[model samples]
Target: MKKKVWLSIKGKQQTQDQEAEIIELLTEGELYNKDKSQYILYKESEVSGMEGTTTTVKIEGDQVTIIRLGTTNSHLVFKKGKKKYNRYETPYGDLLMSISTKNVDVEYNEEKDPIAIHLDYNMEIDGAHGSRNTLDIQVKH
Candidate 1:
């Protein structure tokens, strides 16, 4: 049962001594539940700098997965106290990416569907340390 939804996605990234960089996007997406997991799907617009791309987010307990297709391609996973690896593909080049998750917090609705999610992690790209990052997503009716 997929339902239309509005998403507020916010992210912040900070290097060792650099100022935190932030991005916020408000977009319409679809939401559904299946196989004990919840999914959110949306298309990336030019404002997000990934036009023509579609993003899907899956949430199950404290683990979250984000997949992107089209202009960019990537599979990123986040689980508290775990490190996940993947390749991020782009027109320029593909990079080896790794995510070390420090925390995952989720807020759920009465139906056990997630209404909000927050993740804290560190990222490495091409074997080089990148940034300490946070991603927050809020779902609106």
Candidate 2:
């Protein structure tokens, strides 16, 4: 079932102590597939620098993968205690970024319905410390 949902994303960069947050109501967002892996699909906003982009969030057990397509493109993998690296493409060029996941917590209902996803990680861009970040995704059904 496709439902109108609100997505609230909070991001914090440790060194700078600057916190950024955005809340978007997505009439096109859908949360489905209880028997297998779950997925969240939504479009990106213009303020985020990816106006025509679509974001796909895939959750399977303890792993989470986020893929972006359209104006900007990147594939991000988050797994507890694991480090993953990928190239992020921008209009300027492609830059390599690494993510070291410290924690991944998924909340689900009794019937295995996904409620939210929270993760904390350290990020590096081109082998330089980027930020210590936390991302919380709330699914409002």
Top candidate, metric lDDT: 1
- The digit string of per-residue lDDT tens for model 2 on 6-112 reads 66655555744555444343335777675578888888886566878898889999999889998789999999999999999887899899999999999987867
| Model 2 TM-score (2 dp) | 0.85
Note the residue pairs that clash in candidate 2. none
- Could you give candidate 1's per-residue lDDT for residues 7-125 as a string of tens digits? 99999999987899898999999999889888999999887788999999999877999999999999999999999999999979999999999999999889777789899999999
lDDT of each: 0.92, 0.80
Q: Number of the top candidate by TM-score?
A: 1
Candidate 1 accuracy as lDDT: 0.92
Model 2 regions more than 4 Å off: 1-4, 16-28
